[model samples]
Target chain A: MVWNEKAECMSREEKEKLQIKLLKEAIEKAYNNVPFYKKRFDEAGVGPEDLQSLEDIEKFPFTTKADLRETYPFGMFAVPEDEIVEIHSTSGTTGKPTVSGYTKKDLDIWAEVTARAIDMAGGTKKDRIQNCYGYGLFTGGLGIHHGGYKLGATVIPISAGNTKRQIEIMKDFQSTILTCTPSYALYLAESIEKEGISIEELGLKSGIFGAEMWTEEMRDELENRLGITAVNIYGLTELMGPGVANECMVKKGLHIADDHFYPEIIDSKTKETLPEGEKGELVLTTLTREGMPVIRFRTKDITSLNYDKCDCGRTTVRMSRITGRTDDMLKVRGVIVFPSQIERAILKIEGLTPNYQIIVTRPEYLDEIEVQVEATPSLFSDEMKEMEAIERKIANKIHKEIGLRVNVSLVESESLPRSEGKAVRVIDKRNFD
Target chain B: MKIQQISVFIENKEGRLKKAIDVLSKAGINIRALSIADTSKFGILRLIVSDNKKAKEALESNKFVVKENDVLVVEIPDHPDGLNTILGYLDDDKINVEYIYAFVSNKTDEAIVVMKLENIEEGMKALKEHNAKILTLEDIKNL
Candidate 1:
C-alpha cells in the first residue's frame, strides 16, 4: 500500500519538477549559509543558479564521507543553531561521526518518510511496533520512533538488547511489527527458538530490517524462522535515518522518497552518472532538508536504480538492494572480493552457521585468506578426516566463489562474537603501507 | 567397546600443545593416551583421558575447541608384530584403518592401540571375531 499518494505516487514529470525546484533552493541555501558548500561551488566555478535542470547536479563537486568527517560536528548544518531542534550522528566506528541537525520541519520530513516506510511494511495505527534500534546518538532508534509516532502506530520504544525481555514483551504486547538490524533479527530468532516459544505465539506480521547490508538468503531465513514478511529499509544519518527509502510489500526494490531526497547513481571510477539499471555508487542530494542541506553527498553504497513505476503503484525511483560498499571491497591476491560473496558461499553449504569471519593476512609477501566458520552440531564429528573433508569442501566452495584459495577453519558453535548492531565480518592484517 | 576420545584444535604454534595440556592438568584431569595429527598450519591433539566430560569442559573453558569422538582401544601383547596381528584381521575383512596410535601400559605387559577406522563398527566386529581384547572405557581409565 502506498503511504502518501500525493508524494509517493506523483507523475514522473511532476516529481521531477518538484525535485528541481527544491534542489535549486537547497543548493542556494547551502551556498549562501554554509561556507563549505560555498567554497566548493566557488572552486567548481558553479553557482546555485547554474542548476537549470536536475542534470546540472553533475556540475557540482561530490561531497564525500571524508569531507563530512573534516567538518565534524555542526559544521555541515546550514541553519542557525537556535532553529535546529534535534541532532543525530553516525556511530563513527571508523573515525569521527558525521553530525546531522534537523529543524522542526526537517523532523517532520523525517517522520513523513519514515511513516511512509512503515506503511509500506503494512504497518498502520492499529499495529504495534517493537523498535529495537538503539536510541542514543545513533539515528536509527529515534528515526523509526518518530516514524511510528507519525504513523499513529502503537510504538513500543524498547530500544535494543536484553533479548529475553524483548521476547517477553513481544509476546505479552503482541506487537504486530518489529524493527531492527537484520543481524539482530536473526539473533532474536535464535533466541526465540532457544527460549522454546513457538513463533505463532508472537503476533508479528512484518519486519522493517535495515542499518546494515544483508543478503537475500538471510531475508529468507528470517522470514521462515520468524513467520513474518521481512523487508529492507534503506536510510543514512546524513540524509535522514531509516526512511530515505523503503521496500514496499511488492518487495521489488526500495522506493526512494524522491521529492524529499534526490537519488543519483554515478560510476565509482569515472564519477559519471550511469543510466538507470546500471550499477554504480549512489550519490544523494537532500532536496528539502532545512537544517543540513547536503548536495551531491557521495554515499559509498553501490546499487542500481530503476525509474520504472513499481507494481506497488509508487512512481518514486526504486534502488536495488545494496550489493556492496565501495569502501568495504577487499583486494585479495589481486582479485577483488566482497564479504557478501564469501557469506553467500558459506551459507550455501548445509550444516554451516551464517556466522563467519574472513581473515586476510600477508605471510611471506603472499596474501592468504582464512574463513573461520562456526560448526553446528551436525557438522561437528569426532572423526578427524570427516571434519577435514568438511573444511576442504568449504575451502573449495569459497575458492569457486571468489577465485581465491582460502583456508577454512571450523570453529566451535557460538565461539564467534555476535553483535547487536552491525556484525564485523572482515579482519585485514595486510598492511599495504 | 567404544572409548571416548577428546580432540582439541591447536594452532601449529610454539607452546600451543603445552597450553592445551596445562588446561587439563590444572583441572586435575589425567590423560591416559594422547596423539597429535598435524598439518603445517594447525594440529588436532586427541587424548584418551580419565574422564572425557571433565577434560572437555576444562579445555573448552580455557577457550579450546574440544570434540568428543568414539575410538576403539584394543590390547595387544607386548611382543613383535603384536599390532600387525590385529591389523591383519581388519585388513583381511577389508576394513580401512583411518589412523592408529599406541601407548605401552606400565601396569600390564600389553601395549594399547587406539584405532580410528573408516567403518568403526565393522572393524570392531572383525577384531572381536578374531578374539582381540577390546579395552572398555573403564579399562583404559584404570590403565
Candidate 2:
C-alpha cells in the first residue's frame, strides 16, 4: 500500500540529505559492532569521525570477494544468529559459498526495495506474477518473492523448473507479469510454441529478467514471441539479490536505489574509483542494511553509470547493462569474450538451440576454442552435408558476433546439457594452478 | 577410371578451416569426399575429389600446405569376403594398414576401400597381382 513514487522522483538535494543521515547511522553501527570494520578502521588510522561526507567514505578499505571467502559463512554478520531471521548465499561456483544474514527489519527493507523495483517495471497489486527464479541458498527466488508479496501481487512462488506446469498455470491463473532470467524466458517461449499454446492469449503483460546478462536483440526476439515488454533487473547475492536496481519504462540503464545502497564505479585492476559515465567495476556500500552491513564492497561487474535524470520519474542514478564481469571474461587467442556475448549470438540465429558450450583448450601450445552448438530439428537435417553447412553458418555468425573465430560443431538438439539452475557457458582449460 | 584424392595440413585454430574453404571456393575446386583426422594438435584434411589434379594445383598455387599421397582404393564385393580379400594381401606383404573407411559406391555391386599404408608401392603391387580392382581417382569419384 506504500509505493513511494513521489519520494523516488524527489530532487537530488532532497535524496542526498536523507542518504547522508542513513549512511551515517549505518556506518556508526558497523564501526561499533562489526569486528572486521573495527580492525579495518584501526589499520586505516581513521575512525567514525573521519567520515564527515561521502568523499571521506573512500578512506575506508575496499572489501573483496577474497575477504568474504576468508570469513567463510556468516563471520562478518553484525547480529547474532537468533536476531537474523533469514540467510542468502552465493552459488559457490568459484569457491566456497559466501553467506549473508538478514534480520526481520532487514527483510522489511529488502522487500520495500524489491517492491520499488516491481513498481518501476510496471507491476500492480492486481497483477498475478509467476516467479520462476531458483530458490534455497540462491537469493534470486526468495528475494523477488518477498518483494512481490510486499507489492500485494498474487505471487505464484513457482521456483524455476517444470516449464510445462509453469506455462499451464500462466493460462489457468491468468498471470499478468513474469519474473525470471532471460535464458529461462526464451526456454519458456520455445515450450509455448512446441505445445501449441497461444502466448498472446495468455494475458501475460510484462517480464523482469536477470541473474544473467542479455542483449537488446534477445529482448526484441522475446518481445516478438511473447508480445510483452521484457525489462532488465540486476543484483547479486553479495549485494542482496535481484532488486538492487531495475529498468523503468524508459528502458534506459537500471536505476539503483542510491538512498539505501550507494554505488561507485572503480577501476577493477587499480582499485581506483572512476567518475560517472566512465566504464568500470561497481562497488556498493549498504547505507541501511541491518544484519550484514557491507562498506565499500567491490562488485566485479563491469558497467558504466548514468547520473542524468531518466525520462522515467525516478531521479536515482542509473547503471548500464553489465557488459561483462572482470573475472567472468575469458581471453582466447588474444580475444576477450564474455559468455553473454555467445548467448546473444546464439539467440540471433533462429532455429538454433540456445544450449551450447565453449570448450577452451591449449592444443599444440595455442589457445583454441570449439563451440559445440546444438541444432534444432527445424534448422538441420540428417544429411552430413547439411550439418556441415549449418556448422559453417554458425561459425561465421559467431566470428561476426565476438570478432573471434570459433569452431562450431552441430550436435543433435537437446544433446547439449541443460541446466536446472545456472547454465555453464564456458569451460576454460588454461591450466590455472 | 581414376579417383582424385588430395590432402592438406590444417593448423588447429578457429578461422583456419574457413580460410581453407574460402581458398577452395575461389579456385572452383569441387570437393567430392572429405574427412578430417583430428588430434589434440593440428588436423590432417583428406579429400577424394572429382578432379584431384585441379584440387592439388589450386591448393598448392594458393600457398596451402598441400600434399599428394598414394592411398590405395581397392574395390570389394558388397559382401563379407570383400574385407578378407584385401586384408589377405596386406597381411601377406607385411604392410601395416593404419586406418580404413568404406565409401558409398557408384558401381552397382561393389563398395570402395580407402586405406592408409606404410609401404604404398608394395601394397599397390600386391593388390594388382591379387586381381584387386585398383580404383583410380575417377573410379572412386564416380563410385
Write candidate 2's Cα lDDT for A67-120 as tens digits: 888887877888877999999899788898898889999898889888888888
**Error of model 2, residue A376, in angstroms:** 3.0
Task: Provide the TM-score for each candidate, comma-separated.
Answer: 0.89, 0.74
Q: Model 1, range A1-433, lDDT digits (tens) per residue? A: 5679999999999999998899989999999999999999999999988999999999999999888899988899898899999999998888988989999999999999999999999999999999999998798999999999999999999999999999999999999999999889988998898778999999999999999888888888889889999999999998878899999999999999999999999999999999989999999999999999998889999999999998889999999999889999998878999898898888888877678999999998899999998766566555667778989999999989899999998765566788788888999998889
Which CAPRI quality tier does the interface of model 2 achieve? incorrect
Give lDDT tens digits, candidate 2, residues B1-143: 32335666555667767777787878786765567776443455777766667776676555455656567777786777879878998899898886666766555577767777777788888888888888775555465
User: Any residue pairs clashing in model 1, and if so which?
Assistant: none
Each candidate's clash count: 0, 9
lDDT of 1 by residue, B3-119 (tens): 778888776668878998998899999888889887675677888998788888887666677788778999997789998899999999999988889998889989889998889
Model-by-model DockQ, in order: 0.26, 0.02
Interface RMSD of each: 3.3, 14.4
The fnat scores of all predictions, in order, read 0.19, 0.00
TM-score of the A-chain for all models: 0.98, 0.94
lDDT of 1: 0.89
